[model samples]
Target: MRRVLGLLVVVFVAIVCAGRDLYEVLGISRDASSPEIKKAFRKLSLKLHPDKNPGDDEAAKKFAEVASAYEVLSDTEKRKKYDMYGEDGLKEGGGGGHDPFDIFSQFFGGGRQQRQQEPSRGNDVVVPLRVSLADLYNGKNIPVSMRRKVVCQHCHGKGAAHADDIQTCHECGGHGVKIETRRVGPGFIQQFQTTCNKCGGKGKIITSTCPVCGGHKTNFGDVEFDVDVEKGMQDGQEVEFEHYADEFADRSAGHVRFRITTTPHELFSRDGDDLWMDMNISLKEALVGFKKNFVHMDGRIVEVNRNEITEPSQVITLKDEGMPKYQYASEKGKNYFTSRLLILCIGQLNIKINVQFPDTLSAEQKQGFRELFAM
Candidate 1:
């Protein structure tokens, strides 16, 4: 009876060991394809890699298990046998085993195919660009800095350490979509289609995750670009950089938009294409005459002189002294100066009649003097 008990115990142990699912070791379902199995293995391997988690025996064991799972699933013939006959099929060497990377090359086409495939575009970015009045007057090139995501250099945007790490999706069976039926009411049902849950609608999976990017496959870094400000551009204008956005998955490169803002100037006030300024003159200068020199916008000295007596509130117009015409074939503008005159009385004197000079003036002259003084 004891001998019989020992045999039964052996049988039970075998059954328990054989029943352990290999899919769990690779963190995947039994229906996972060759590519999906590889992708999952690579992702787990990187996290539990001996090089990354040194001195951790558990992690090392996990990494080994992941590698082993990839080795079996990546080979088509071996994978087929494993799917049909379990692990025992490979013990007799009938399975035509191949390297995991070779299987990836065959399934994905080739190296050239991977490179020629279109990558997802990035997002468009925008920023406010401030410019000086002078810059606005004569366009300029402005440099800008920004941060954005770029494809990972280590994995080349594959999101895996190697090609062998990719796997076909089990949930959708590589179709990338799933159909479902839901009961709307008694004896009635509605059908709808949705992306596969297992593959997240991609119809594929990463067996081995990229060690450098950890499956993110992108890095954040600084980007510098130059935007051209066109001449004669008005305030609040925008300059666009075509296809210069931050690179990412799911879309093509977008544009970088720059909004232009003109800074205020102390010396000049802009009115359309004309510039205005204030000039002051003394009252004496206004009554008599005055000549003055002022600086133009281009730093040239211009002299303005007035010889005629300028009356109070009289305006002096300077032709062509305004701002340059904007895209107009005209160079005419009026600069007006309003004069304010202040008259001053120095003194007043009262003198005796000069016509009777020396007390010997003629009677006619005296009469004339009396008459002039009477009024």
Candidate 2:
């Protein structure tokens, strides 16, 4: 019976692809490699899919043609025959009776023999991580401890004590859904399908559940790892650990992301790559000029000097003295090692001057100032 159906399909495909060259349909050379053929098919199928090109008849037809071409060309034996003798050779039992959407699903999400559906993904876990502003200036490694669900080791995530103890659901015929027809009116009938309660949509029943996980297929466990806080990483930047979230039976684990939060510094504030700070100066120093040692975030000393009178509300700009410029690993290239030199990669530091005036002037000081200024 299946052979008859296969023959009918072959005949239909031969009719549709009668004079069309399979290689031309896929826009690839006759000697294209297997990976090339697959790549071409994936690209064309995505663009010409029926869902993407809704209400477009020409695209739908081309989509079918592309799928047909890939179906025949992807198979080693069928491809050999089609290459040698053309589409007619496939009708002689070269094995080209597969569905096109099945191929798409196999590449996109589900493996062969499964319905076309998006791959299941678990939810991501985001945690807040606080660090000092100095940590962002100088890269730091922060150790983090997390509690996540891991697959049961004893049952290997099967949810059953033994493989033989698992059986297909009898209620839905292992499809996990039941269809029923009901009378809607005197002469009308309605049909609808619902998830089978017996199997909870799992399509399998475990007679002997795993003692450790109790058929849940996972257990909570503690895990620890170091989160690298790269230099100049912006606030709220996430450090991601892939596939480290809670585990499920058949779904892929999501990422564990740590959102970096930099703590406020007492002496410095940042804007993009620049650092702003307030510098307090005494009235005498502002008038006569003075040199002061300014401590940087990494304990480096920066000399703040003025040879002339320093006015209040003055701004002093220091080049390449702020935060380190953040560079991605890929962007580092050959200059990564040299970037540690502040002159090579850094930002500006702006210091705003605030001069404190003396509350009371002595009579001798006022007289001296009056005589010096010839008032």
Candidate 3:
């Protein structure tokens, strides 16, 4: 009975020591593909890099553990050994003499030593900006307003109420990584690796949460900006705001992009760089000739006059009346006016005349008189 109890206690200790779930370690479901496992590892590496979080021993340990798990699972031979013998198989050189980190480094191109840090640029954000057609034609600077995420002023972007609240991570032993294993099929086990949970893979912990942001690194608000639209600028053209994106804790930011949108105009339709306006004329005016004038968008007067007969569907060209040329040249454009004509005809009229024909009028004259009188 004493020997049996000791055996049971040893088994319990073994189970307790091997507590991590491989599936959960890699943050993937049981059915995750090999490629998916690799992608998850890369993402976690970037997040929990030792350089990103300094002096975090737990994060470093977690990182190494995640790397080890990936090394075994990513290989067919080692995977088989791990499947049969578990961690013992890997430890006893059943994996054919392979260094897990070496394999991981080869697959992910190896880790880099900390180098000179550079100021990070912000991200770029895009918003649709609407403008009138007239504004596009004449060119204008549109003032735009939007709300964006900015750094918190109270905590100086540390996201904590005070510095003392921050603490080192305990789970990964400051390595910021963890390892896990799963049974794939009969006699086959797959291993997965992931960031350490206790430290959120950061290999560090915040003993005291920030009172302002509650340990969340970010906050939100409004930002106003201007978009300069050039004359004859086409719709959907992008207006850029350099380095105006969301603020980061490390003071890195991105840019803001604005897409220009034009509102539909009642009087005109735009085609490329040209502007089109339709004018209607009566048939009488088209035939007898007439003068027509209309107001332009810029409050300029445009007139069309013709003394000679104008045919229907006749187009008259007006120089320098179209939209201003964009980018290529500053030359003015031309305007085309169309004309329609209608003609009217009256019936012949009859007249009464009393005339005395010569006394010697011929028989032809008498016939003519009889015909005329009958009509």
lDDT over C-alpha atoms for residue 78 of model 2: 86
Candidates in order have lDDT scores of: 0.58, 0.78, 0.59
| Better model by TM-score: candidate 2 vs candidate 3 | 2
- TM-score of the candidate numbered 2? 0.63
RMSD (CA, Å), candidate 3 to true, equals: 29.4
lDDT of 3 at 209: 57
- Name the candidate that leads on TM-score: 2
TM-score of 3: 0.49
- All candidates: TM-score: 0.47, 0.63, 0.49
Point to the candidate with the largest lDDT.
2
Q: Report the candidate with higher lDDT, 1 versus 2.
A: 2
Candidate 3's displacement at residue 317, Å, is 2.4
lDDT (tens digit, per residue) of candidate 3 on 135-163: 87777777777777777766667666777
Which is the better candidate, 1 or 3, if ranked by TM-score?
Answer: 3
Residue lDDT tens for model 2, 1-375: 324433444455555788899999999999976656776886698777655665675676676678889988877888998888877787875455455555555554423224234378788899999988999999888988899999999898998999899999999999999998999999999999999999998788889989999988899998775777878988987776656789887887877889989999999999988999999999889999989887899999999988889899999899988899775322212222221232336899999999999898899999988998895
Clashing pairs in 2: none
What residue runs in model 3 are displaced by over 4 Å at the alpha carbon?
1-123, 178-194, 250-252, 328-375
Tens-digit per-residue lDDT, 1-375, candidate 1: 323432443343334324345677777887774435645764575455444564665664454445455666656677778778887775586432333223322322332233344455455567788887666555567878788777788887889999788888988888899989999999999999999988999999888989888989787777766666644455665555545566664566666778878787665556565555544566556556778776654567877687766554444555555443332111121111111101111111111111111536689988976997699
